[model samples]
Target: MLLSCGQPLPLLRHTDVPPRVVENFILTGYRFPNYSLRECLLSAFRPTNETGNFWTHFLPFFIFLYYFVEVFGWEGAPHGDAQFFYPLWNYFIGVFCLLMASSMAHLLNSMSLVVREVCFFVDYGTISSYTVGSSLAYYYYIHPRAGTVETGGRNDSHMDLKPEHAGSLTSSYAILDFSVFFETFYIPSACVVAIICVLSCCNTRQRWRRHRYLIRTFVFLLPFLVSSTPIFYRLLTRSPYLSASSSFAASTSMSSFFYRHCLWLLMSAVFNISKFPERLAPGRFDIWGHSHQWFHCCTFLSILDELHMIKTEVRAILLSPTLLLPPAVLSRLPGPTVASTYGVMFLLQTTIISIIVWFSWHANSIHGPERDQLAKDHPKKPLKCH
Candidate 1:
């Protein structure tokens, strides 16, 4: 049973392992594909069924990590406008952490039953981490709280300056009805939501296993919908003068960014739901260009698009950074801006990593139970390959 890593990999039939581990024909592959931790990392360098999945997000993770280091670890950071750079650093690190979490989930694919559960935990956790990253950028750079005269010391929505054609260098700013919401608006309690989501996805309950894909997708997107509710709502009630306003271009950019983000994100969901390209031509997609690959690709593109949007928003605010809050109010805006974001990202990532590690150490604990569950779920024997 203990095969040497140096030996040539064996071709595993669909029946070689539990049906749940490789549920569909596309998930089926040869033996020796499941290697030890050290070989698994090395296997990424060679071609395998999981190559595309592992590298798709893995490469993007490094790209984002480089940006994270450039923003915070470098000497120049913490030197200039600390206020601007600090929040930006927090945002970058949040993104980096989420990307890495996603990559690891993909990297550990087609692993043993116990290992797969740990990856499931990591994958589910990243859904929230990515949402937190997005919400961080939205809160800190996209739409911080600002008080207007009519609101009476209340600042929660994003305000756009309407540029009236007057013989003046400056135009008076008014709150746009299509106001963006604060980061803490619906995001403050996302941690609880995240915990729930992870549990729903990772639990070995029979009810959850019935409609697994739908359940996982809904749970994954729940956090995204919860955090992005403000943006979606603002778009619904957008204004006519929004284009001609000073923040028009930036607003347009942010809207475009959000659309792109949602588009790719939904594309990922579609690929997941439909199991496309592969479903059309079954065995052809076993190695690459499958739904999972497209999902990761779309996710990477969406994240990349947001990076540009973040830069545009930050630059726009730098022009009139103090317009929203006075000196007194500025001192108390840490929760939504940077501190809370940092805290949430760290908490989610650490807890998820801990769960993954624990599951791994006690892997044998779940093997028997999960295999038994799979046997009950699929009472018929696995079909023999022709």
Candidate 2:
């Protein structure tokens, strides 16, 4: 079939498409299966339910790529400071992988059932990787130091300590030294959470098949919560902002950007779960303004805000020498760099997704002939145009 921006192949109604690809309340603009590869590529220019989903991330992918290259050339690779740039590189790569995977999944999933399942599985894996990317950036560049809290941004050694209270103070300090533990295991914990998220998401896709929004949301949200534990802890304790110095402005900027991103993430989650506006008026919003499109936009905004937050904090840390943790805190920090962490997560998530894809392909191979026969026998009736 000829697919183009001006004249596209005839779109299918909701009832005309297979149940697997159907979106709730989207009554029109569904594409049929087994389109040629060229047709699938051209479908991005065609008006369909998934066209927005494709372009939304596809366009943003280039935008992110530009930023990545800009950063990579400017300071990331040029400076040769792996300590500082590796986390940023990891974050950029994750965003790139996520956007490309999601856009492709939306674009070419109609080629076949197994292809669709594998595409979504890969998409979930990229999301998991992105969570780890965020965690790496947060752990390396944004986490508040334990000394910052104990000293309250001051260098006083005897300001508050008394001879009689020294022992209790030591115990209290020990109790409050949670940052050490978090800093040590934060990236590793994020990697574990990401793996679990992929498994749960793929499992939900396989098992639930339909009405799995809540389960999918819960699984994905768990990873975000876990990856952002340091951010939540910092925000709640306001540890980084306790000082009333010039750095206060820098801290405020970082916090404000963080808040904006958090809000974006919340909105994205709501859209993903609620599927509103389109749900309220099914056919009217079928070709546009769907919740998934909104989710993509919100998530893109969240990433932008997060990038700004990290950049701002990095600048602050560089300018203020005192912001660097003392020897005691640095000694407790994790040994592995962000690059190493990304390498490990990349290998693990790839292996897990490969196994899931194999399972999905195998399961579909067994059932594929029957489903094809059913489609051939019970061809859809001609749908009336609205």
Candidate 3:
């Protein structure tokens, strides 16, 4: 049967037309009969083409969520236990938001230049939020705050504070400290994001004038003012109370070092720039073992390592009371000393070793057909026509 437009109602198929053309037809307010609807729906829900994009972006969120919940529910006390949990939770949430934003941007970006521009802004916003959130989390947990005090067999109003909180009121002050810290990193990052967005969106002539102005104003100025002042003041003050050295401090420092400096920065840079393997053989590594995929793997590994460190530290703190002491040490140690010292070390080592083994095995076993498919699908010059 033919529709009102003289088009066959039962013969339409996406195979007969490019996906772009179909998208355009729909965007331009065209309608089709049963065959067209079937084709459109099939194209929209196609498993093969979009699965990688969906899973790659969303999987990180789920994985992080699981870890966050598990860690939060863990019982027992460690150094900075409450502090560690809160910041890490914020960091994970920030990362999850970033992944979601990035996924959306990548998925819809190729639809049109306008769509690309919008998505780019969204992606930048997500990244900024992530940075801010992570820094804030760190600041909150590291800084000192008010604790409860008991007097005369009852809770009293007299202020009780840790060394870190000396001359301050509570952990709430950390909010301001974090705000400044966030601004420091975020301003420059925001500028970079803005420049990228403008250059991506604007034509050559328009970019020179209009985009530059926007970049200098919104991206440069705002971030500069917000991030710089507070960071400068904090640095100048040399406040020992800002961040204390606890077991949690050691664990978080190690984790952050791996994630922020080694994993996230290094991996993201390599993937974005497509250096090394990608440069040597562009299309060859596209499908399964591309630079991007490797980057993802590295990121996951980094996060896992961080989580392990946290877990180890927590376990160590909780098990401190049960560990045995060496003969020489036990003779000099107080009753609680032996268990706490040995327990901490044992838990730390166990967590670190277990995480290392799991990741190493998983990494080794990843070679398969998926890698081959990626190479085949993503040739070096995938965008040569454009």
lDDT values for all models? 0.58, 0.70, 0.39
For model 2, residues 211-316, the per-residue Cα lDDT tens digits are 5777777787877887777666666554343244444455568778888998998898899889987988889988889999999999998888888787766555
- Candidate 2: deviation at residue 270, Å? 1.7
lDDT of 1 at 166: 23
Error of 2 at 249 (Å): 3.3
> Can you write out model 1's per-residue Cα lDDT over 35-96, one digit (the tens) per residue?
45765676676555666887887788777665444433433223444555555665566666
Model 3 collision count: 9
Off by over 4 Å in 1: 1-7, 31-34, 65-81, 109-111, 145-185, 204-207, 233-248, 323-338, 349-364, 368-386
**Judged by lDDT, which candidate is best?**
2
RMSD of each: 7.1, 5.4, 17.9
Question: Candidate 1 has what TM-score?
Answer: 0.73
For candidate 2, report its TM-score.
Answer: 0.81
lDDT of 1 at 40: 64
How do all models score by TM-score?
0.73, 0.81, 0.43
Model 3, which residues run further than 4 Å from truth? 1-53, 76-90, 145-261, 299-386
